[model samples]
Target chain A: MILWNIWLTQDYFEKQNTILTYSAVISKAYQKEEVISYEKWSECQNYYTNPENLDFLYSIPVTLAILALREFSDDISRRTET
Target chain B: MSIETIAKAIGSILQDTYSRNYGLSKGFNLMEKEIALSSYHLLMRYADNDEDKNEIIATMIHMLSAPFSDHEIDKITQYVREIFFKQYPDEAKRVWLALIKYSNYKKANPSFYRYQDEDSLNKAEENEEKFVQQISSDKNLTLDLSEISLEKSEAYLLARAFVITPYDTDDKDFSNFLNHILPIVIGDLTKVEDYSYNRTRESRKFHHESISDIEQYLANLFLEANFENSKSIFTTLVNSLSGNAQRQRFGRDDLFEFVSTTLDYFVLKLYDNGNLKIDP
Candidate 1:
């Protein structure tokens, strides 16, 4: 039960954070470039803001990270406890 | 219970639960055993082309493998239609009209069911093609390799080169250093989404002592050299130097050589001139 709870919490955090991080990283990278004018930035931002694109980008990392973290944490805990 | 009954029961339970979850429906199971036998009987009663039979079977299998719910599948279908129809209206319209006619045919005759009758098969192929085209055409989607700042680009490139090299260090310090630096440099280059400073803080724990040792050495060297504002000089030196790339490149012999050469040059400039003194 303790293991399950940890798994759940970590899964939630990873999914929420990865999406936040991905968007933040993309925005920051765009900001770094001088050639991407504010108007162009807004246009690109609007494009990515579409629900399908946002969900697609967000879901990939969330699902991958959750699977990886769950397996890794389970293995570690099993070793330590046994 | 008998073995056949027991096996059937287990299979039924699995089918009810994870079979759908894992994209294995009854049709899929049947199709897997004998490719397009069911579909060919229903869809191509008048047609007898071996290649078409194989193609339809392949498309059916591909659709069955996709992980999507009924609702999500509908959304995907619509999204594909919009993208393809907008971009290549002529071809897209032909495919769209064919799909509509196909859908009507399937709806009108329940007995005419086949693997090829599924709209999802064609929709998946269309979606895959559109995705490839979008990735190829969109310039913004392409990674910007030349945009990296010159001062930091070499360090970033060197860190990448360091990752491919083997390490001999048993000390946790070296492992910790590589773990810390590699991500930051790669993250910067790849426009990776996370740049939280917390990862850096965690990595610093491994080399905290070594960094302090270096800082103390520099402080003493500056003091003995009678450099004015020795404290400020030490602070400036520490501030001006970044450990992110250094730690990433830590275990490489080439990196070790670079650091040694750079340090030797600095020492020669300061101490060989009799400007600095080191107490034994």
Candidate 2:
């Protein structure tokens, strides 16, 4: 779960700074039917809601990931506005 | 299933998650460049001798070249050269000779300033392209060397002497090809170790040796390349430089002059082919 959070944070940082909009793994996930949305993020939400998807410890990383992404996005937005 | 089962599941989940995200990258190119340079400095601090320094430098270059532009590689190489030159003259010369990236990027911007990020690299590339297009392309300078008729004259003989000429070719065509290639070759010859700086006997000998090496490379390249014009006097020059025929005994200054002229042909060919070397 700690490792998953780190990976998510790294992914967010890469996307925020890069010129590329989409990543291939996300596309591959969608192609494999592991993700169903064009945005490639909808599967995570579905997993969160599904009771059968009970890796309860994984929630810790998932929550931290959401908060970190929000803070990062907010920081970028504030900087851009300034 | 108790604590052991839970730990195993966690480990499995972590491995799966990390594996999925392993190749997710974009901005990492700039990050990778930064890391490579920092690693070089760290390596330099520990490098004991000239051999160790050169081996590490070469390893660093081989590792990072895939992720960076040709210009970026040259920039890093120049930095490494400056650092190595104080202690390792021979190793430095080897590195300088081997660096033959055929781009007008350096000619466009001579500064060795490091780019801060991807934005700056892109901006530098844009500015360089604009500069190169302005300076290089528009001249449209056409040469008609045959009209000069320097046939059998010292200038013609001097130029002709450098040419490999293993096979037969039109004298006029060979002259025209040589005329096209000499300038770029001379520019490169003077770059590694400027012979004019001291004008001493030793420097002249060193320069001559360097030019011979350059000529060997030109010979090798001409034999390797698939030229569009097969019937070109280039074919004759290529065959001569092919080094397959009996090696000609060329003296000091004459060898330098001839190799300089011949290598210029190779240089022009390389420059023309530079467009095909797409950046990462």
Q: What would the per-residue lDDT of candidate 1 be over residues B140-247, giving only the tens digit for each residue?
A: 331222322222232322232122111232433223333444343323322222344343322222122222223233333443433432344344334433443444
Retained native contacts per candidate, as fractions? Answer: 0.00, 0.00
- Rate residue B175 of model 1 by lDDT: 34
Off by over 4 Å in 1: A1-20, A23-82, B1-19, B22-74, B77-81, B104-280
What TM-score against the true fold does each predicted structure earn? 0.19, 0.23
Q: For this target, which candidate reaches the highest lDDT against the unseen true structure?
A: 2
Give the per-residue Cα lDDT of candidate 1 at B231. 40
Off by over 4 Å in 2: A1-38, A41-82, B1-179, B182-280
Q: What is the C-alpha lDDT of each candidate?
A: 0.34, 0.37
Indicate the TM-score of model 1: 0.19
CAPRI-style docking class of model 2 based on DockQ: incorrect
State residue A43's C-alpha deviation in candidate 2, in Å.
Answer: 10
